[model samples]
Target: MLKIKHFFLVIFVLIFINCSKDEPVDSQETKPLVSAIDIGNSELPYIKIKTISSVLNEPKIAGEMEIYINQKRVLNSTIGIEYRGSTSYRISDKKSFGIETRDASGKGKDVSILGFPAEEDWILTGDVFQAPNTIFDRTLMYHYLGYELFRNMGNYSSRSKFVEVELNGVYIGIYVLMEKLKRGPDRINIESLIAADTDAAKITGGYILKIDKTSGSDVLGTHPLSYYDTNWDDDCRYTEFNSFRSNYDINRNRIAFPAYGAPYHSNKYLETYFVYDYPKAETINAAQKAYIKNYVNDFETALLTDNFSTNTRTYTNYIDRKSFIDFFIINELAGNIDGYRLSTYMHKARGGKLKMGPIWDLNIGYGTGGRVPVNDWIINYNNYVTNDAWMVPFWWKRLMEDPQFRSELKSRWTELRTNTLSTPKVLELTTNTSNYLTNNNAIIRNYTKWTGINYNYNNSVTELKTYLTNRLAWMDSKIASF
Candidate 1:
């Protein structure tokens, strides 16, 4: 009986020992370098994000993320991340992302990143990725350069910085950590308009609108409009829910698109729609919506009727012409094919004239598009791509017709060319950025992961410099005539 009792005790001890053993560890934290590039010695700030969920598929899923800068943990909070961009997302394996920082309770938490102002919204723009042979902005500086140029021109463009990123445990590549365009004191710096502010002065101003496809991250509590939606129609196609179609066509004529809507129609360029961004589709009240819509209509009417009579309200009565001039100069210099149309942002402050920008999404710029020649204004997009669904607003072309507008544009261009947008200054910015990345081994690290990127870094930089030099020369010669 004693021997049998001893055997039972031995069995119990063995069972306890087996059960207590740590479950076979599957965490890859120790050896997470999936790419050949060794990021241990990188000079750029290292951002490591470990998500609680194994995957980030869409904007709605809030994954718990622990953020570390240079291996020191700074934020351990919930983050909603998803692939951003329409063409970039579909074509590239290395995808950019839209991020929203949230707290433990799932509300937006303001956190300052890379010394920028505390904001819940941020973006991680991936290095350019393309198919075998295509016109890719390989320098990866188009966005940074464009934003810097705009900011230097005395505007509040999105502030961005280069940083190395690690997802889960794998080093992805170098990404541009940028502030998302939102209304804040440090950002757009516009007055807030809520549903309750339906009074005359409060409702007349403080609105952000986008002339973009309804495809990216949707306004909160609203369904995203598919790119396939019929964007242009006789009824103007814009519903009161999210956006409003322009009362005038691209030619300053009455609203009309004979080919009507998307699916590649020839006359789709005739229409334009302004998507409400600030108060958003879910929050903006009817009075606020009506006021903005009417305001835009009034601007268009005033602009279209300028040449009709001296008594007609001038276009200057509706807009800040300086903002327009600066906006035009930056877009023209960057050779931004999508300028004035897609990704364009315009806002109005309380009792202030409508203004253009805090420019956003400039990745596809710097002579990438073959649709228009390098010498022409991008606002002439309609004249080039006759069938594009999104067209430049009649505002730009109409504004250019004004002698004062042309004189101001010419003066601004000449002034900026001598300093801010000068060929040497622009090239210096490009070269310095290039040298910094290469000297710090970031270019090698990024190119190693994103093999689709232009691996010949020097050639890409030379190409960018050449493009800018030629573009600046052309603008200098052409703007002199104005």
Candidate 2:
């Protein structure tokens, strides 16, 4: 009887020990990156990004991060992240981020996060409310409007989706989650111009360039041909490069592509203004540079010829006329003072003509800026500046010289005014966007997180609506006279 009792006791003890054993795998696997929350469709989707303290302190450095969306774990990877923007970078406590999807080991998986287009790189743009020396464009819709008009113009433009981001368990404000421009199946859609594509025909197209503010980190390269001042009738101001100390003023535009080397440092003399944007300045070979340079020179030669309109040598031969017209209309319609001069982009396909734009960076368009009178034409660059460092290229003045260009532009404007650019359509977009943000509690949440920040949706919408109504009427009158 004693032995049997002892045996039962031993069996019970063994069972208890087995049950008490900890299952690390189960606990780790079941633990979520964040606690779940119910969200409505009207609200912008919420995202939680987990980060280590090391990364937050140095936002410039890339680190491993985990992402959760609307209560579901989505991505786990190491990413290269950096603070984005120039003026906005200096002003805002809320930081905009440029994120590279690759993990610390440089491994990445492609998946659509928060329903944005499938891309490895993404930008989380903070509202530029904190930017310095700027009249507050309270609408916060300039960028959204810029891209919308670009799309309605039937061009391939960056698709943006609104999102609320939570970093390391802290609620950050609303972000315009968007695609980072690059050569891809979807992004830039040009044939790959790898170093191996040395053939003249293979290399010509598929290049992207931009005119934007240059930073110390920019990979600069130069054309040996002297830089042109583009003063129209004034002889093209030539800057002969002697060395690094050449005090040549930076050109308004930068060379964004065909950079071959990826070196952070280079021995070559940097272009006075053009920063190599693609193919890493270290990667582009001598031949590639010559090709792009010659092509640009040839185009300019045709452009600058006094009899370009009357003669066979026309600027249309070198550019996509429709795209250029649409770009101009959007900029002019928005009254973007920075339109033609800054944040402008142009691209050349392997065999296609130079195309103007996928319009970008318009936080200060409309009546929101103090640079140029909101009601005045932005093309009148001389109205505000006496000796501007970045002058609008003579292209605008010359194009207007051609009767055909003007006719087409006027016709296009009229049609769009009835269709996509119609006032009713624009007002609807404004109303819908505002309601969506409000319904999602995004506006309230965003301003709340920023502490001391105030947002009035109705006022922003009213200003935007009023500006559009007047701008459209003014454009109709001006275009008709043009």
TM-score, cand. 1 vs. native: 0.85
The model with the greatest lDDT is 1
* Runs with alpha carbons beyond 4 Å of true place in candidate 2: 1-42, 53-78, 131-136, 216-272, 306-313, 451-454
Candidate 1 lDDT over 306-355, as tens digits, reads 77334344677788989988988888888888899988999999999999
Q: Can you write out model 2's per-residue Cα lDDT over 1-482, one digit (the tens) per residue?
A: 99999999999978744432221113244324442333444346555555434332123454544444444444555556666655455455676777766633455545455555666677777776553323245555677777877787788778888877777667776788788777777777777777666887788867776655542112221211112112121111211111111122222233453332222223112322333445545566666666766676566556666473464646677888888899898998888877876677777888899888878888777877667776677876655764554446556766777777888899999889888999899888878888887777777776655644555667778878999889888888889986
Error of 2 at 245 (Å): 16
Q: Which runs of model 1 end up more than 4 angstroms from their true locations? A: 1-37, 54-57, 64-77, 131-135, 219-238, 256-267, 308-313, 452-454
- Candidate RMSDs in order: 7.6, 10.5
lDDT, candidates in the order shown = 0.75, 0.63
**Residue 181 of model 1: what lDDT?**
91
